[model samples]
Target: MIAVFDRVLIANRGEIAVRIIRTLDRLGVESVAVFSDADADAPHVRAATTAVRIGPADARRSYLDGAAVIGAALAAGAQAVHPGYGFLSENAAFARACAEAGLVFVGPPAPAIETMGDKIRARAAVEARGVATVPGIARPGLSDADLVEGAAEVGYPVLVKPSAGGGGKGMHRVDRADDLPAALAQARREAAAAFGDDALFVERFVAEPRHIEVQVLADAHGAVIHLGERECSLQRRHQKIVEEAPSPLLDPAQRAAIGRAACETARAVGYAGVGTVEFIVSARRPDEPFFMEMNTRLQVEHAVTELVTGIDLVEQQLRVAAGEPLALTQDGIRLAGHAIEARVYAEDPSNGFLPTGGRLLDVRWPADVRVDAGVAAGSLVGAHYDPMIAKVVAHGATRADALASLQQALSATRLPGVTTNIRFLGRLLDLPAVVAGDLDTGLVDREVPALSADPVPDADFAACAVHEVPSGHGAWRADGWRLAGARGAVLRYADGDGEAVVTVRERDVVVERAGSRAVVPRAELADLEVRAAEDGATLWVSGAAGDRAISRPALVRRALRASSPELVSPMPGSVVAVHVADGDEVALGDAVASVEAMKMEHVLRAPVAGVVRLLAVVGAAVVRGQRLAVVEPPTDERRP
Candidate 1:
């Protein structure tokens, strides 16, 4: 038996760090954690045996700074470093640095990371190893003209993907030849912003494609084994939301074939430690699976793989890093039961899945299944990091049972302040296609409207009223109670554009919205969970109807900005670029500036055709609804 390191520094943060710490503690090893100013009070910081400050909140200065991380490891007297995915997990330079420092890096070699890190190179390398890759045009440097010409030959409906990043950050789909040029420009900008490499490749968009990935572990002694597969087709904008093990779409023979291909791909680069090989399988033809790219580190969905295989992947990484050989052979591995995981993000499904952030007022995790969370009550959910707050993983004897268990777990989850996709995930699982295991990449995007059509029920408004009113205030407080000194017994709350007027009577609470009234008894609503924000300006009410966030209406505030022609930032982020100059004439819906947050870019457009007055400067941080630019109507069309 090989001995694990005495001390290891985890070079990442969030749930992954907590997960690695758990394994390190189980094996009696000291786990060192590194955090930035923003993560000083994070859950992962307190979970580690020892912690060190890295840098500031900006990732480039902290998590992405390889030099800072190496310095921290050396100063902490760590024998090794475990990059738990993201940040520098796939950074070849960082891996080489660790090796030079006489520290074991719990991942593949630098050469392997280099080869598999680039999609263009990865596609070529795997294809040389007799692996079937999806037909596409990939190279180091392809100009816009070159890509446009290649797209025509590769046929329309192609995906433009970045050569360097793994997550679907810079990916775009063009269905027609006319739109290929514009898509290429936007893809290049995003690719450069995300990966510092604007190189792109075009591949044919598979109709009804299913994302299947195989987890494999290899040691430095040249032994590799597969740990089955995971289905990750439930996605929005190419980001996976839900994942399950032992894809229901694959039969026994197909699973073996894909598993063999995954091992062969790993062997092509002499990969060591744990790695996941992704494949794109056509839903209509599940037998023919095409090679996608290899993730050189542990995946976010690795929990589902572990649940089915009964293997501690983090422990395997630690052992492999200590120069251990295969503990189990190919034939000895067994895949039992099934597992499903839902990634809970701080995002609003109803608002185009825009990222949301705030102080978490209260967080209650489910008790039944395994939960990997990065935040706790009073934790700050910021815009500087990935919005995924936690993951809920459930295992059962069968696929149906696992699905049901996951749904129940999600319903029991509660995060008061920040908006999450929990309710939407519960609804997505009930969709006919997802329930029957008939999934595709576009399913979530297509069904977004129906899945996000949750409306605030009147009962929730009544619950908020009960929770917000002071004891001596005659049961309810009106909008003008504090401002205008009016002591009315009616409450006025607003959600988005809708308003609700509530009255608390002796035994019943009456709620009126849009000329409809509903009376709910006080005792009947006693079970509703009411969580107030720290400032008491907002109330989150949870009941059988659903979760709702209500706040007192600002009638005067709304009236002042109702007729203002301004283009505002929809989310809190930094202004990356401005397309138009001050006083430049712009048409309606014209792109004015770009704002980036959580690694996603959003373009702000002019609301009316008029001369532009830019108010936002590049590199300035802005908040949600912060005005970025304004359009002044010409004097001929201006209102007197």
Candidate 2:
């Protein structure tokens, strides 16, 4: 059948928008993309057949502007609007607005969205229908004291979940009454910031539970089916970083049970298009699961489900919205081989996994894997959206094979500019628990100490000889440069906070303080750090240590920047809020100010207790390492 709409407007940004555009293109349907000023040149905007500017960089004025988005869609002659996940995907008002405008909303019914959008209402709805829900309060407004009393009744160690949002924002675990108030406040603030809703619902915190979610596709007709289940147990900060379909923990019987339950929930809600039913699978119980929440939109890890199901869920969404019956049934659905997806986010796992922003100086991926990338080389991972830059999915006959293939893909992938969780993903895939398919929401958190404890390779300096001078030096001369008095001269290199010197003499290289040495071949002197034209030679001159490669120039520049004794903005973003001012005394680790980039908040904190001298004001823009404030230690204070 022809597409339900001649053109569907993708009211979103980033990889998901691009992903939907690709599907629309494949279906011979024209695609429209509405981008904010911040996303004018984004890959999604470029991929769309028609593009329209909505508003400024601020999401509220742009992506979150329902009227602006509707206007853009109508102006572009779009007959449908696809809110790809976040912004307005589950917004009942937006759904109603689209319906009133006579535009197809590629999602569940507005009533369904309204009913399930609030976690509290969703819990009550599912519970009333006999679906198991975590024990908690569904009521909205109550004093903190009353809420604490509710928590006591429900039991301590309750989870404070924002009733209005998803993606783990404002999700807090309260173990004590004192912590409940703070958790509730923070949850409200984050919920308001992320979803424009501060209402929260308290739930029983299921300890060490595996997050299993069923992907469901329903049509305007009565057909509803489940596309197996995804194991989303591996996460940090409640955001799923790694996901796989056909959870290892579930047997066929259990899978069928969960899938049936997911279908039942969708059937009860009259859900349409694509949605997910998330459940917390107790590690203690294993088979029995409690309903957590439902996402009435496409998911970030949809690729893995697609890989296993061989169904174009987005196409199904469009078709379902187009008034067509679901093409497949639960009887037709069958899980294929295993597939694993690792989200490549622009974040530094070492530093509390804070979002990192920068122009992608270099971005390359392995050819064998399916890479749903949102950014290319030169693409700016700004501070106005989620930091997920790309998703790499690999499919294989077995779970182990899929994991291995994904590991190879991640290891081979290179993203040089901003700090990424690529290396962390590789390590995560290798974790003993991860390898054995033993996982829980806390597995990643539990392994943090070991994952981040490893120091940068000691051979980093020697490796920089290659980073400093890439191949093609001496005008195609492979021989090392001849110094005035030596075969190869000593060069300085920095790694993190330390510096090292390496002496290269033609075919031989010597390290000063490392007490390690490796002899280089005269023909292959560009080892370790430089990529050579195909010769089958090893990249690094392997010594007793591991093969290392690092950019000496980047490291040296980093070292020079770190010499400053002032707190600075970590990336290019606008200072949205400030907490401290000049002459304000702050203790170490106190948040002095916060900058918003890529929609993620980066709070600048005092590294040491001192009097702060503010340099940047709220609403001002700052670049990476630009001083935001100078802290004067009291011990070193001047008399004057």
Candidate 3:
């Protein structure tokens, strides 16, 4: 297996790039990384053999710019380009351009991409092959008026999205006739912004369906096979959260049927390289599966398949791209013990799962599981890319064993600086439904309250007081003062939970709150890093329990931001939309503007019902807390 290509250019960023580089290195194939200004110091860039500055922080000008990627590849003297799952990975034109430029595109052929990349066309192809598809209306030249009528025929609840979209971008669930038009418009907006194509369609919305997909591998020699099934039903916002191989919901007959259908669908489109054929399995009709869509590139959840099969999908992808036949046949592919993967994101589970941006102070992954990470302890998470920080996959001999390992892995995963969904994932894993292997796409949203509920232990807050309380401002810094003088510091947050005064007596931390006092272990309070730099107060504690943090300086910054005249960006990102104008009256909960960063959209809302004064324009770059619009209260309800 002489190296297929001397050097392969990784035409993306983040964890996927890191994952690909590891395989390329093992194959003795050098890797070149292309990045924007936001990723000058990213782990993936450093991991590659060499790196090139593609463009600014905005994804369109850098990662999504097909020409720039190819130019960088040529300049780096790379023989091939590996579009790592996102950005331009599924762009057929990009694939054609790479071929036109004499560079090997490490993915499906352009014809196959053009065929399956469009959901409308993919559905037609699959349906022609006798594959079952969800009830829907989609085709070129389909009118909005016709779609509204189509919705009536399809039923009240349906999904609207771009014909050429993946992930959850531009996808909307409309449950009412009145909401259909608005949903379509918003879906088109998102679709256009994400894929540059706004041709929208509608499909019957499946109620609480299981998202299962089959991994398919093919070669130029015409060999193709399915690598079993992956249960990707655990999701939120239509994005997968947890994935496992050899779906617990599938028996031998169902598995064989679905696998055959997937391979049939792949071979139908002349599919090559590695791909995933996703299906929606209704809870009511467990044995029947509906063809949802096909991802022509490697999937984010491909790791679970690798863990179960003990084969490197990336290596196989590379070999296929080099025109080599797959080294293994379907008979040789074996699925062993159960494997589970959990995606760790930079999001606040309690706050409507809003995307979070901040500096990663400390990150420690569990040593037992396989951790694929994109950031380091000092890495900065911005509103310029996807918010996913890492993925943890645990494998065991049995499903129960795998889940136990996954639970422990989540507990051992530590990311103290920025907010994360670790606590939420831990709780989700403990649910009875999950324990019993009964799951659906609606599980997370249905149990939001309990799933996101996180109660901080008293000791964790005491740790925050020790690290965040200013050195001299807090009496705790003073040794037990000579006489009777009480020494303590009051630490408060914007949260409704109020404040607490921590009194330092000898080596112990006495947390006094609501007229009650609880002693905290002195050692527990001093376990992790504490820093109050120009950014903000950072308090981190990683112990046997888990990682937790609350930056008081960040709260103060928010307070100062609230003092401004307008609602502002919660994080730094480019303004994609503005819905209000100067002097326009608006109500609470109205979306005044939408800002996007790291592939997550944050909708700014009116703080008070009043006249709106716009301060930011669409496409304007804004920073954290940058004012976007000001809402003036009515004369009778005005506040100073």
Candidate 4:
């Protein structure tokens, strides 16, 4: 087959860009990659045929700058621009700009993007074509008062959603009428910050909602077909955690009905290229699936659909963009084996799932599964990008086999010097509800306490201590031991259950702790991947158990208190809002400030009821564990 285009420029970064470049290379096309200053050394940059630096580290001046992307494409002598999943992929104006510049945009037309990008108009348009949408009050220019009124009419437990943007950003779930006003305010603030549009609508919240989306393909010749559905019910904070093709909840008849509805939705908007039509199905009524929205470009979970259908969705997108007809008909498309994908994010599951960033010391992936990774060893995971670092996809003849394969793949995946959620994903797959194929959007949230309850294992503590503790043979060692025999150093963390007393000798190491004791050979600990911080205060150890971080207990205890009088930022980010001023009286649990990181907002609240002294300034960058505020008892309330 001839190449879709001689040269194509990718207007995105990370794993999706690499994924697209792989397909472009297979089709015998030259790939051009654009990167910000931070991503100049990213994996995608090295994988492309040629790379260009668009702007500085700030995404606004680089990846999200549609004008800059188009200029790079033209300068590189590229015929088309492929906007992979995020950034400006769904921006209608960007599509129009590409067309006006005589560049083929590998996506739907501008009108189609404009119609489906806005949830309000998309809902109305699809409903006009006899498609089912969640019962809601979605319309343009709905004021706050109008939303309040609509919320009451829609009944309690209504969902406030922004008209523009997807990925569950700017969405709030209000379970009571009194909370609607506050949720609406927060939702509007988030919406405006994220998508620059605060327009919101109210919808009846679907209890036990299961997110199922159908993959559809269209050509300019007016042919649209569905490539089965994916079950994306496993989520955290409204973001998908795991996705799989051929949902176990749906039979042949139900799948056909949902597939038809999805096809109708595509035809309604004249959608082209590969797209996903999302639906919200109630666990009670699995047969009746409600249209959620249509993504104008490829989905992050598109790999799963491609694995099951054995179709290269990106290749198809390229062919269609080059004015080719549908390569396969509805009857020709077939679903073979089951495929599952688990998203690996650079986050600490035990630490409230906050985003983590650092230099990746050692990155290892299993060869048995398909791993699409963005970062590698020596790569810096920064705060400017999303937390997702890679995706592990596996295919098997049965759902159980696929689940088991994914679990093993996650265990074998190792990323040191940065925290990850690989262990948590493995545990989630073992949940009885998940094993039985019974899932809902809220399953992850409800089971977070159990899922993140990771206590530092004795083996991990021993390895960390062995790798960090100084040798006792030297008189000038940090251990500073002059006893009759050699003494070891003790290490502990603020959140650790107990201390690890480690004694490193020439031949073997001795590690003792409460309820455990072990003496292992020094060669064993030396072989493990141990990355120490520059300050030598923390050590990250990666072993068969997974990655674990060990901090110097004394240092952490001195910085933090048992009573917790200070409020600190959980991750490195910018202070977006400060609800309390200096010397303001704040009650316990009162929202004092909010830190924005990785496109998510985390509210830091007062830990004690006292007069608060604010330390964080809005729009100022902060580091993880940086003090943001302090609460001191009033004079009258002071005991002394």
List all candidate RMSDs to the true structure.
Answer: 2.4, 4.8, 3.0, 2.5
TM-score of 1: 0.96
Clashes of each: 0, 11, 5, 1
Ranking by lDDT: 1, 4, 3, 2
Rank order (by TM-score, best first)? 1, 4, 3, 2
In model 2, which range of ten residues has the least summed lDDT?
A: 532-541
Superior candidate under TM-score, 2 versus 4? 4
> CA lDDT, every prediction?
0.87, 0.79, 0.83, 0.87
Deviating ranges (above 4 Å) for candidate 2: 1-3, 453-455, 458-460, 467-483, 512-565, 574-585, 612-621, 634-640
Reference-based TM-score, model 3: 0.93
Q: Where does candidate 1 clash, by residue pair? A: none
Per-residue accuracy of model 2 over 248-322 as CA lDDT, tens digit each = 999899999888889878877889889999999988887788999899999999999999889988988888888
List residue ranges in candidate 4 displaced over 4 A: 1-4, 468-498, 503-528, 558-562, 638-640
Q: Per-residue CA lDDT of candidate 3, range 1-640, in tens? A: 3356989999999999999999988888889999899899999999999999999987889998899999999999999999988888898899989999999999998888888879999999999888899999989867789899999999978988689887888887889999888778778778888888889888998987899999999998889899999999898878888999989999888998999899889988999999999999997786889998999999988998999999999999889999988889888888999999999999888766878877776778898889899999788888778888889999999999999999999888777667889888888888899888899988988998988877566776676666644342434322343322345455543222545565544466676656577888677666554444335544566665566665442244434444444787877778998877778888877879998876677788887788888989999998876778888887678755
Q: How far is candidate 2 from the true structure (C-alpha RMSD, Å)?
A: 4.8
Candidate 2: Cα lDDT at 574: 80
Which wins on lDDT, candidate 1 or candidate 4? 1
Give the alpha carbon lDDT tens digit for every residue of 542-623 in model 4: 8776787777654555334436888888898899888888999988898999898888899888888999988879989999
Better of 1 and 2 by lDDT: 1
Q: What residue pairs are clashing in model 4?
A: 492-553
TM-scores of all models?
Answer: 0.96, 0.88, 0.93, 0.94
